[model samples]
Target: MWAKRYLSLDASRPAWAYALDAIIANHTTKSAKAARPRTKINVFLQDWNANTTTRSGLPVYARNLLNTAKKHNLSLGAIKMDKNLKRKLPLWYHLGADKHLKKLNNTTISDCLREKHGVTTIASLQRALRGEGGCDAPIYGQESVRDNCTCTTCQDLRGRGCKHPRRCRQAADRLLHFILPKWNPEDATPGDGLTLTRRRKRRNQDMLETSEGDFVFDPSVTEKGELSEAFRVFVEEDTTRHPPALRPARGRVVHQGKPPVQLKTSSTVFNALRAWKSAQEQMVSAQLAQDKSATLKKR
Candidate 1:
């Protein structure tokens, strides 16, 4: 890769442009499982002080090299300091190079040094320019390149699934939310300051809704009575029984609804129930009359 980029023309960039990247690729990297390596401040200055020649045999100063690396998303250690670091370091004597060139919020060159450094200490985390390609189709829009496939290869599949092994959602987000510049509309912008409004799942909705490009919110789910009917049962029957599971993991809000306002719609059953109620009332009134008569006779 270095040899190929070295031979490219003016617009294609020079070989010296990839020097920091080359240095980084050849060294051991920091990981979650490993201890952090300390890259002192002298290494970059050494190269800068020594006039390293370019591919054209002209002396390319390391100062210009650091600047070029910055343009390629590499942060210079001698300039920028991380806000999270504890001990303070002198200005222009920063520890490592940050491969990810995004400026941290409220951080500057004079702040405490963040321990993000390699053995040579000029580069840290590297951020890559996200491609505007998709896994399934160029039009599907939400997914990113699959299995590190090149942008051209990923966009080839005009149907379903990914051209590569994996489909990415972040690619779609990065592409859409990035603010486009007025000067060069074709140039892709990184999504830095933009905010994405997250799609929320409505309450009592038990359906599988996707947050894809074709998102639609249907409030009719609540009005359909599928949830309300399951939650509030008026009468106890085999149909109202919940699924059995273990000792007793019942639902928290499970309860019977109010009794039916008009029970037994059949006229014969309704009439018989009313007659039985009237007969009981008449018998109670007769018993009360007999007790009153006995008390008056005694008086």
Candidate 2:
């Protein structure tokens, strides 16, 4: 009995001994599956100070997390901030940091956490707060290029204009289509709103009252260099002549894209438009009155 319990058993062992070995094997298999080892992720830093330094390499980890989330096409729940960061870190890092230390420069840190590398989670925060010593270089800044750096940060710093003409064209089309009806009601045909027609050039445009004076380049003029410049100048001049209620206040001069001019029809065209709208209102009022009188007579 002692040998059966203590010593290893072979195939020649008794049936009771075999049954005991089977039970032990089943328990060992269950334990192995239940307690499968997890792959541990290690965060290491040579000399990072959490209390003094602006960076803690947490941004690197945050960036990794963001990439992983994107690779798997997962949407992390909304960014949350731990409230204890203010007490843990210096006041400078807490600039614009909210009650829960959620934001930096009015942008949510959690948003940056998912989009770019930045101090995000508690682990990263601890790393930053506990960081001891490191150089004061920006963790991620404009990388040096041989010539004409095209990285977004460098391009923005250099005030590089948008090279993509399609985006500019789309924005221009949206504005032109939106303003075309207000500028010339005659040219607005019944069709999809995307379509527009430009008035043909008349023989003489000396008179301001004539159709020649009111000529605007056709929608196809956007494809022409000289005509497009002329159109742009006309738009800028006309919009600046009168301030519209909806026009946003001009602050700084932006060189790229279209200028912020709320271009509309010239004064003569606008006056005619106003008169036509007034006549429409009167016609609607007269129709309503006639219908009301007829209904009363029938009653």
Candidate 3:
């Protein structure tokens, strides 16, 4: 049977001597592997008055335990602290120690996966978070590129042209005839309160106003260099004369009839207008030079 001792002391002693004596005295006739070993215990004798305290006696007791175990042919493994022991200690205590000890208790590989991939199998939820999947591809596959075919309409048909002899041009013609309208309305049911009449009217009015402006260049006048300088002057003078309408401060434009007059010169607008005028001058100068060259050649 194994023997154990618990001691309390007021002063320090030679614990190593006591430990060695205990190891020598406690012996059994049975096989070493089958027999339970007796452990030598020591309580440090603390000297309150002495300058040399029992603080250094801790490691001595540890060493004595290890030596006693070794002398008795007992297996002695290195001491291992609990994994969560560092968590109980303060942050500063474990800062310079093992990196695994410094890691947060709540942080895990599952937590990281949840953070990066937007997936959490830890809890029961219906759907995962947004942006979990990568970029989506179009449902109807459409290839971009042209192939051999001399006709303009056939050339416009994208992708490799139909290889079959009789139906090749016919297939290209059918594909070319396909008219894809740009705008698509969201709700198209009969009672869905959606009407195309109002939208069509607004679109037509915008188109008419856009076409009313005289922006087209006359080929005959351009040949004679007649309206080149005059066009430049007209653009500059018109921009200066009519500025954009100002907004009313208190109410609607109809309620106030006129906005507060604040005269300000926009640097951006001025620079743009200056650039336009410079370009116009360059064009006119080039045209005049070309005309003079032509006249000299004729003489």
**Model 1 per-residue lDDT tens digits across residues 1-299:** 43224323236556565564344323322321121222222222211122233442323444354335434533112111122120122112222212222122113211212221111211111111122222333334345333555555344421233433232223222322231121112223222222223443342132344433443453221111111121221333221122112133346834333345764378888999899999999999999999999999999
TM for every model, in the order presented, reads: 0.18, 0.16, 0.14
- Count clashes in each candidate, considering only residues at least 3 apart in sequence or on different chains: 8, 9, 2
Model 2 / residue 118 / CA error / Å? 41
lDDT of each: 0.31, 0.30, 0.29
**lDDT for each residue of candidate 3 in 111-188, tens digit (9 for 90 to 100):** 322233222221111111111222122112253122333444333322222232112222212222221111001111
Give the lDDT of residue 172 in candidate 1: 24
RMSD to the true structure for each prediction, in A, is 27.1, 33.2, 41.3
Candidate 1 global CA lDDT score:
0.31
Q: Stretches of candidate 2 above 4 Å error? A: 1-258
Clashes of 3: 2
Screening candidate 2 with a backbone cut-off below 3 angstroms (N, C-alpha, C), the clashing residue pairs are 47-133, 48-131, 48-132, 49-131, 49-132, 50-128, 50-129, 50-131, 198-218
Worst 10 residues of 1 by lDDT: 118-127
Q: Where does the lowest 10-residue lDDT sum fall in candidate 3?
A: 179-188
